[model samples]
Target: MNTTSTNCYLLAIESSCDDTAAAILLNDKVLSNVVATQEIHEQYGGVVPELASRAHQQNIVPVVTAALRQANIDKNELNAIAFTSGPGLLGSLLVGTSFAKSLALGLNIPLIDVNHMQAHILAHFIDEEGYDKPTFPFLAMTISGGHTQIVRVDDYFRMSVIGETIDDAVGEAFDKSAKLLGLPYPGGPLIDQWAAKGNPKAFPFTKPRVDGLNFSFSGLKTQIMYFVQKQVQQNPDFVSQHLADVCASIQYTIVGILMDKLKKAVKQTGINQIAIGGGVSANKGIREALTQAEKNLGWKTFLPKFEYTTDNAGMIGIVGYLKYSQELKDKNNYIDTGIHAQSRLKL
Candidate 1:
């Protein structure tokens, strides 16, 4: 270990999905965050695991180098190297994991393994001038392409997932619904864009009645498919004419389903402070809905900026800094050197 406690520097890498990101944090303050998004995935409706891994191999080195250069820090100044250890694509995780391990070994520094999901939640703690950090025991709704869960965070590492999706994630719902409208590969953003111009109540889609906090979007997805199929058969140009309405209605339903469960979670836990993370948190509908809830319900809500909401190394760096700080508080809390990537590692 470097044993350089003062002015600690950490380099964090995230390759959980198609994005290869790197960030440099100095004493919990992120100085540089660089993300290389794969455009090749735009051709495919969804990510191809093999291609994602290959892209990571090509981007990881340059991304990390750029991050360090931007941060105006030398590799030798890094006290520890942190990398996402999973709850992500196995192939993608390997590229980051291998790079982190090699760098730590070369520099004779400590290696910190971060859980991607946990990183998303802890991202709120990344040092920002005006951003407010959520208090302890706040509820964090992590919604993204691959995962969706409502978690109760008692501390940095102590989190309990109270609710989660049983089938497809909300991001998938948006994308799949967009595909039905003949939208491109990443239909989620398009849906959001079109939804902005149309009436949310123009069309009413059935929302699945899921018990408790566990969600089921498969039924809602099927409902959209059947509805679209029927409309297309009647008028081949239906999608073209009603694109905005369809997007608005779909976004409305998805946002409603999420908000309903979030309200229930707050009622159940009695913890009013709500925070959201992950990529889907960037949706305007969800953000507006949550903000409205705060006004009507007198709840404190935390929403990260657009850049931090997505899969990026800034979040990973925050987790790394938190974990390192925890270890410093108690040597017994130190991360084991044998830590390895886990595709389904729980929060």
Candidate 2:
């Protein structure tokens, strides 16, 4: 699509997982971001693909409507429709993809495809009055339920995955650890909350010695499991007695692992600018850890607002706006409207 106009209006949809989110972007400004969370998965302990997709179907329309209403924009004014196209549950991605395609076609607008993982990184650019955007050649560490990666972003579309988890992501490690402690679904946040009240060094857990920036959290999970089991054997109420300590120790280990890798990336890439995105970034421990890095390591950090930190359409709209700007710069930079949802799409 080619547009010589400025301040283009974009409607973005995100149903990559359990949340059905919609947002409106006027140029780089995010006017509205509405996410309908799926609490139905709470009882199940994790997201159930089938249930997530079903909930998305039920929430998409109203979510989009609310987003537009909040943004005070009409569908007819949209220059394009952007939607997350991959690296998510196929069923969930399809819900957003189908809806975006239909709406784009109905309004005769172009369809913009966004990678779920990339959106997590580009989320740093979502408009905030005084927020400073990260310059190119920066390192972006995206830690989420499905991904943990260190990316070298040279430009809008020029990104390279420098390192990533070979097995489980940091978010999974947190949630799984919480499960071992009898916490509820999406226990990552709960762990963070409790971690605040306990000593992070209360318990000792061996950190994985993975070479380079590649992460391995499966072993950490196993360590916690066995440790918890042994404690329970000694005392049936061990978890209940030390819930806060357990959470703090676990969060401490995870944050250390992440910060160590981030420091290594900075040293290896010589990129002083570091940014983090995804749901895991919302953890208070991780946020403080990263903030401390700026003072100790002379590094500049970018952290998105809590709302944009999680899976949301506002991030998708940022990508759409970037791609649209590319088209404006060079008409030959045409985006493929023929794109489809890719469940395992790479960043």
List, residue by residue over 144-178, the lDDT tens digit for candidate 1: 98888999999888899999999999989888888
lDDT of each candidate versus the true structure: 0.91, 0.91
Off by over 4 Å in 1: 1-5, 329-337
Which regions of candidate 2 are displaced past 4 Å? 1-5, 329-337
> How do the predictions measure up, each by TM-score?
0.97, 0.96
Provide the lowest-lDDT 10-residue window in model 2. Answer: 328-337
On the 0 to 100 scale, the lDDT of residue 303 in model 2 is: 85
- The per-prediction tally of clashing pairs is 0, 0
lDDT per residue (tens digit) for residues 90-123 in model 2: 9999999899988887787778888888899998
